[model samples]
Structures are given as C-alpha cells and as structure tokens.
Target: MNPLLPIRHFVPDTEARVMPDGRLYLYGSYDISRETTYCSDILHVFSTDDLVHWTDHGAALRSQDIPWASEGHLLYAPDCIYQDGTYYLYFCMTGSYEGVAISDSPAGPFHHPVPITPADRDSIDPAVFIDTDGQAYYFWGQFHLRGSKLNPDMITLDVSTLNTCIIDEKNHGFHEGISIRKRNGIYYLLYTDISRGKATCISYAMSDSPLGPYKKGGVIIDNINCDPNTWNNHGCMAEYKGQWYVFYHRSSQNSKFNRRVCIEPIFFDERGYIAEVPMTSQGAEPPLSAGVPISAALACQMMHGLFISPAADNTTEILSHATNGSWAAYRYLSFDAPKSFSITAAAAINGGTVEIWADSLLLGSCLVTPTGGWDIYRTFRCPLTPVTGVKTLYLVFRGNDLKRRLMDVKEFCFYGDCGSGNAD
Candidate 1:
C-alpha cells in the first residue's frame, strides 16, 4: 500500500517526527468514521522504518488520560518530540487550550497531560522545535503566529517570555496549523493559509531566529485540488534518510471530515528555498513496479462513483457504487508485452466486468461474477493488450443500476514479465 493511505479511518492533522531510534513516528487527530468533529478523544501513533510498511502503535494518548483537560474534549492536532530520554507530546483540545503530555517512549501511552496555555490565550495546533544550542521553543496560534521559550521540564512555558504576536498574519499569510523545523540554520515556519483561495494552502516563512519576525516564503502545498471538496489543509515537514517529505491531508468519503494523511517528497534549492510540493498518488515511496499489489486506496484518481474503505486482510476495498462510467486508476506501471493480471474481489452483482485501460487504450478485463455476498471472495484473471514501457493503469467498473454497488475489490497485480529488472 502507498504510505499516504490512512491505516484505518480519517487520521488528519499529521505531525511527523523522526525519533531518536531512526523511525519516522506519526501523531495525528483521529476522526470517528465521517463525523464532523475533529477527533474522538484519542490519538494513535504510527511508526515506519522503510516508509513502505508501517506499524500502528494504537492509542498513544486518550483524552480521558488527561486530568485537567475539559470533559469530552476533542483532541486536535498534536506534536511529539524526544528530549533527555523522555517524549514530550504537545496537544490541543476542543476548547483550543494547549496541553503537554509525557511518555517514556516515542510511540507511547503518553500520560500527565497538563494545560500549558493560559486561560486568556486560547489557541490550537501546537508545534515545538528544539534548536541546536539545546534551547527549546513552543509555538501555537491561528491568525497570529505566537511562541514562547519552554522551561527545561518541557511541560511548562515561560509565560514571561511568551510572544503572542511573533509573525503578523496580515503580512505572512498565516491562518493556522503551524509547524516549525530548521535546516541549514534557517528556521522554517510552515502553516495553513487562505491567501490563494478559500481552501487552506500550506505556506511557509523563514527566519534566522526561532522567534521569527520572519519573511514570507511561498506556498509549499495547495489543497484546492487535494479533494474535490477539500475544506482545509494541515501538514508538517521532516527530513528522513537524506530525503525531505511534506505530510498533508485529503478529504475522502465525499465529506470534509473524513480527511486522510498523505505525503510527497520535497527538495530544497541551492539557495535553501524549499520547492513547492505537489500532491501525488505515488506518495513517499518510489514509483511502484508491476508486481507490487496496488491498494485501491492508493488509486491516483477516482471518478464517476468510486470510493474506498478498509477491507479484511489489511487491504482497501474499491467500492464500485453503480455507474458504468465509474473508474479508479493507478499511476505509472511498466509493461513489456500483453501481460496477464489478476483481481481479488467479491461481487454480489452478476456479470459485471472490470475493464482495464493502459494509458488511454482499452486493454482486457476481469469478469466479476456473483459471489452470493459482497464479502465472499474470488480471484478473477484476465489478459491485457500488448503494451510496452510505462503507462498509467485505469480500472473502470461496468454494470447496470447507476445507484447500486458492483463489487468490493481488494487489490490487483500484474505477474508476468513486464520489463524492468527491479522496481521500487
């Protein structure tokens, strides 16, 4: 599966940090199904070593675990950092109050969440950055970018040193979702802005100091097309294994609340200007080869009436909700000749076919027969038209009843020699 595909349900507001043990750990707000609320009082942490496979470190911290947090408070965006063998988790609740938690491990059952922000200063999206000189800074805000020097305990902010208006949003395009990271001694402040359009776009600002009277950079990511109905964008940046990645979210299930995390590689120019990172289907991982099982959730684009959900076996099921024109596509496949492919699915509808297309040309298709139940599984095989080189693969579902589902497709794979000795 593509690393960008959410492990389960909507896990938005991603904050990625490469921990001391060299694994990339992800902490994000967990949404319940397709609810409009931010989160369901708990957060899960996921860690990946190779960027291809990830392990879910379930229930890192729950709102009930925090004593001072308001009752039934929704856990919003959170950030975790390792300092002195302890993990410090900075988080926000529905009331927009900031809190800090402590854990002995990176992926943790974090405990002891204490409110850090003052009662008068209500804000969300907390980001903490530690400088090279061993000084730690805390940031949180919406329209006005704010920060303060943290006490050595990392649980308390130096309220006397708080700068409530560090960067003016009117000049810098900072609306919300602040993330701080340093590269080459330049402090980069990445945040969500509505300067380009109504949709939240990830913009950046750079300065030489942690407390930045920073200069506005440019948009690192734009969420206008992330989803047809994308409402906002939230993300963070991290450099892993000599490569830089921008982590963001995309709305799914035809709702803005069901946003999923996504990532794409980014690069810096010689002048240290970070390039604009565009959203892609082939996230973080390298281009997929022919034999790798392409998860339906990783479909480059789904049009007509297609959707995805988690299925058994850790796979994503592509739901063909009626409409013969409905199609899902996987980008960039290498083929040598007329190769055979197989689809794993279960269809309750009879005589439906998954028409395959290489690039724009129609290939063959796999017949989907009635399996009694949608959960009943079957493997359908078919051959494609002779093709060579690289091209995008499109699977269009054909059936009657424009309002009914066709089948539940788990995955598809090409097994024959389709060129290329190795694929990443």
Candidate 2:
C-alpha cells in the first residue's frame, strides 16, 4: 500500500473527528484533481481505523441538493459533531452563509440543510463544539471571528447570545478556519493566522469557557512549502485512542487550489502547551508491517506521470505513464530479517523494470512481462540483497523506451526467512 498517501484528492480544510465507534471520520472541502477551482460543490466522507486504508462513504451533501445553495458556488470548510443520538454537519456556501444538515449516521447523506447564519454575516468555515455540560457552540468567520451558543436543536444560534468578535483578526490573527476542542478543562481555539509568514499558519488561543476570553497560545504549526505554490493551511485536531493528532492540508501539483489532506501526531506538554509539528513523509502512525498486503495507493510520494488512480473496473492501480524517472515511494516499513519482494502488476508491453530500493540501497529489479493486455494481471518476483530493520521503499518505473506507458501496479508484499520485528 502507499502507506502515507492522502485518503482522497482534493481534500482541503480538514476537520477530523473520532466517532463513538472508534473510527476516525473526515469532513473537508473537495475539489476535482487538476481543477482550477479551490473547492467543489459537494462533500464526500471518508473513515479509517488505521491511517493506511480509507473507505469512501460517497457524497454526504451537494450544493445542488440544497435548495437555497447556488449550483456552482464553492463548498468551503465543513465540520461534524455527534450529540443526542444525532449527527449534525455544518458548512459554508458560496456567499459565505452558513447552514446545517442533520443525519442519524456520521457518514451521511445529510438531509434538511437550512440556513443558520444570517445572510448579512460574513461567515465561512463553521466549527461546532459540544461542551461537557451538553451545551453546543457554533463558531465561524473569515476576517473576524464570531461565535454563539447554539440552541438545543443544534442548528440555530440565539441572536442575543452571539459574540461577533470572540477573537478578532487584528488581535488573535484569526483570519479564518476556526476549530474548537477541549482537553483537561482547557478550551482551545485553533485557526489560520496570517501573522506568521507569506502563507497562513496553524495558530491557537486558549479560553476557560467555550466562548472566550481567549489568550493567544502561540503557533502550533508554521507555514510550509509543501508545494512551491502552497498558499494556506486549514485543519482541526482530534484525539483517537488516547493519541492526539493534527489534521491539515497542503497544496500540491504546483497549484494552490489543488490541495491534499495530511496529518501528524501532536503532543501537549505537562504544562498544557502544544509543541509545533513539522510536515513529514512518515505520517501519523508507526512503520507498517513488512510482508503484509499493502495497497499501491499508499505511496507516500509519487513523481510525475505516476498516479494512484482507479482502473476500468473502478479499482485502483498505479498509472505508470512510462516517462523517464517516474516513480512512487513508500516510507518506513519495518523488516526484522532478510526478505525478497514481489509485485502484482499488468502491462500490455514489455521492456521496463520495476526497480526496487531500500533507502539508498538497490535491492533488485523485476522485469515487466507482457500480459496480453493492460488489464491482464500477473505476479512477478525478484530476490533482495538482504536489507534489515526499518527502511524506506522506492519503486522506480524505468522503460527501455521512455516515452511509452509502463505497467499498472496493483499491490506488493515481502517474503523470505523468518526474522523477529519484521513485517507482521
């Protein structure tokens, strides 16, 4: 599997929540790959137990499905929370007006989306927090931060209780994308702050109540150059199985509009301050076990012409557009003892080799054999040079003719002498 590949593209403005069932669910703005738009007009939900494999729950809501929403307006940041045996999804539409939808399930084809925030308010990026006392609060804004205590219905906010300046842009750097979460009795307000650098950084403020009195808590992550055109960052934090994580997005394909979601493990010190987290290819979990079935879609990195995309039957395969130096990389797999690797792939033409490497060391190569058709699948194997312990894996697709497409890789696994601490 591409162990660290983004769950699906193009997911931006991520809000991660751990459902009562223990699975992590993702809510974000979706965009078509290589599209010019910042986000699409629909939302798709994805869930996972381990970060490696994700199941798409299909479209949760669509702008066209909302009677008040314009057909092609951008579907910006969204959020979801569970309370009273019901799940509520909040999102911002084209005009920056917010709305709410209700569903019995977390992964929903949510229904009855009625406008919440007034049309006059400049609202986007809605964040919902349910407090320990059963009180729910809704937060949203762009240039300025505004919030209010939500009514029992979880959709409407009391106009009298609204604070249109919970944390202003000038004071707390709250440009947009606000997320609220509580830990150890501390109310944390996370958002995009422009005070740091060229692109927005993930900064936070702390409060004693759901609607603060917030004090600047400093930055939790700085702006990054994940892609040369990277512009802004937006995300949320959730604790899963006693581990805390930061969910964020980065622009890719050299376009600021084409963003992909990424995550990293985060920590709060004994003093209750969060340390900054750096972007990494290793991802949020421990090294995956060797010799286990790994989806080719888990590639942590892919060079040009190499894409993990769906095939004719709607299953994913490595689209190897045989350009010179096209490659895919999966990082940090644990191997306790020596082993050989095998790959399952399909190719209509022969002459390219799947070059395997462990870190900087070349393990071996498997020659691509003609399989009668591009969709015809077959297994190929090659002996390794006995690499031990944990190491990054690189699969380079090199062909005798650089201009033609290589082969589609379905999956890969390792096998050989038994060794402790190797792939489970």
Candidate 3:
C-alpha cells in the first residue's frame, strides 16, 4: 500500500539513492514524537530490490555518535552519495549546521562525522549531487537556496566557490528539503514549495547546470488531506529500471508527528514538464488484489479526525477515533464482481454503521454491533451489490454520538463469488 514501510515506522524527508548493489536505499530522519516536533536522534535506512517489498537495514547511524553535533534530536534531513568506493552521508542538525559521515557500505552505521560548515554558517537540508565531469555540488538553505563545490575530502566545502540565491521563496517558491537530479543534461531541483502557504507541495525547478539560473516548475505531489495536520512534504526523485518515481510521505495519528513514507510514479512530457500526481493508495506498485486482506491504516485520505493508531498487539495498527462523518478513502482498487464486504472492528458501546462506496456508487452498508471494548476485535460481513472495474473505495462511518468514538477498524477485504478469505 501507499505507506511504503510499516505503520509505526515514521520515516520522512527522504532521499533515494540507487547503489551499485542493485538496491535502492532510502535515507531519512526518524520521528518518534507523538507531539508536534520534527526528527529524532536516530537514522534508519531501508532498501528494496523490488519496489513492493522493503528490507530494513536497522539503525544506520545516530546523532549522539557524531562527536561534534551538540543538538542530536534535530537530525533534520539527509542525503547519500557514492564516490570512489566510499559513501558519504550528508546530514544537518540544529542551528542549521551541516555535517558529513562516511561508510564503506551504502547502508551504514556511518561514523567519524565532521562538520562541513562553520558553527556560524547558516544552512540546513543538505543535498549533494555529483556532475558528469567529476565535479561535486553541495546545496542547502531555508527560504533562500545556497550551493557550493565540495572539497575532495568531501567533509568541507570549497569556501571561495560558494554561491547563494540559486533559488528562493520569492522566485522559485522554495521552503526547504531540496533534492537534486538530472535528466538529459537538464538539471532538476525538487524542494518543499511554499505555494499553498504551507510546505505541503513538492515543487521543482530546472536549470542547465548543477548550480543554476533555474526556472520554476509546478507541483509534483501534494499531501494536503492525508491527516488533520498536513504541513510538509520532502522527498527526492529517482529513475529505476526505466521508470521514474517520487518518494514522499503522509502524516498519521491526526498529529504532525508519525509521518509515514509513500511513493508515486511520475513521468516527463515531451517538453520535460512534470504534471502534478494525485496521492494514491496503490503507490509504487500495482492495484492491491481484492482477494487479499488490506490494512485499514494504509488509507490515502484520512479526514475529520480519523487517524490510525497502533493496535493492542503492538505491531499492527488500526483505524482510530472514527465516528459519524469521519471517513477514509482508498484510491484505485481492482474489483471483480465482489459479492460481500467484511471488516474487523471493535467498540465499547453500541457501535455504528460503515457505508461502503465504490467512488460515487453505493456498494452497500454494514451495521456494526459493539464488541464490548475497543481492544476486542470481531469480524463483521455485509452483502454488497457487486461492482466491477478499478475504482476508488470509500468507507464512511455513521453513528449516534458525533463526539464519541464508534469503532476501531483493523483490516478489511472483499469477497467475490469465488470467495477471498474472511477479514481477520
């Protein structure tokens, strides 16, 4: 589903790199907050040979290990690059101070970190790109974008070569979290665009050179309704197996924290313009087969205070705090004459009804009875007026009390004439 990793893994502000090992590695800051805050001290790297399945390389690095960084929890955003058999992890911490860590392996417990900029220098969200002619460029800044050439050591920048205002809020709608890429000699810069008065859009800019006189492009993706608090989106662009993808994230828990990673396929037109992509439940893979159980936590549109929380099992998650008017929609599901709809739900009271809609078509509605407790789960089934073809799925909850919770939804699936398994 769209949240590329597990429900509890809050990985955001990511940069994707395809290493020589033939696996695409994800480098990003870890968020462990339930409150309104940003990053934690740890770094987690995930890899996937195939886009659908991912492998966690565990904790690759931590801010406390960096002897020079005084503010550990502010490990904002990171990017990795490979040069001459070594991998460099470019990271930024509090006060906008940038640093670099090294490891022989692409997925690393990267150690021996050193500051790239002086304590007084203002910088954040380090994006490193190497040009074709053997020159490397370092980019970072907030509101205003900055770029410079990195020294051969790769830890410090070439001071004399620093360039400022490569792109800015007034000109390019720049906010922060910049990722750089190039295609057919055209350099593209992806950053948090300030277009919607918030950093919810991933906008782009293009130039002829690595550090540029760039032109602003429109949005690639926007995370506007993913949660009650959709504030920012920061990700990078990558081409793998002749396909281009944008790695981004969506917020959960009805809070600014607990954001989960997501991906969507994107492409360029004849003039190389990238049209804005709508966020979907079927992310970097094909439509989820209706025969298999789909987690309720992978919802693409969570609205009206409907968010997901960890289930009592401590591993899986379930739809939480849902009541009347709190609904969620899943994008683009393949249905083949599905006969019945089933859900795993729980409630401490009389419960509620789940109105199932296939886009605008009302497939059916299931009356839910209380399971006596929110932690007690029971599967309920309702006969559906079967609908076919690929369509967006909507689950709208209706209950007597708007202020009280109706049910906690864990997982759900559709049954065809041939029958898929029960929702368990």
Cα RMSD (angstroms) for every candidate in the order listed = 5.1, 6.3, 2.6
TM-scores for the candidates = 0.81, 0.71, 0.94
Two-way lDDT contest, 1 vs 3, winner: 3
Off by over 4 Å in 2: 1-8, 119-121, 288-424
Model 2 Cα lDDT, one tens digit per residue, 136-165: 998888877888888998877877788878
* Candidate 3 RMSD to the correct structure: 2.6
Residue 138 in model 2: lDDT: 89
Q: Give the alpha-carbon lDDT of every model.
A: 0.76, 0.77, 0.85
Candidate 1 lDDT, tens digit per residue, 168-188?
568877788889999998999
TM-score of 3: 0.94
Q: Estimate the overall C-alpha local distance difference test score of candidate 1.
A: 0.76
What TM-score does candidate 1 reach? 0.81
Best by TM-score: 3
Using lDDT as the measure, the top candidate is: 3
Error of 2 at 26 (Å): 1.0
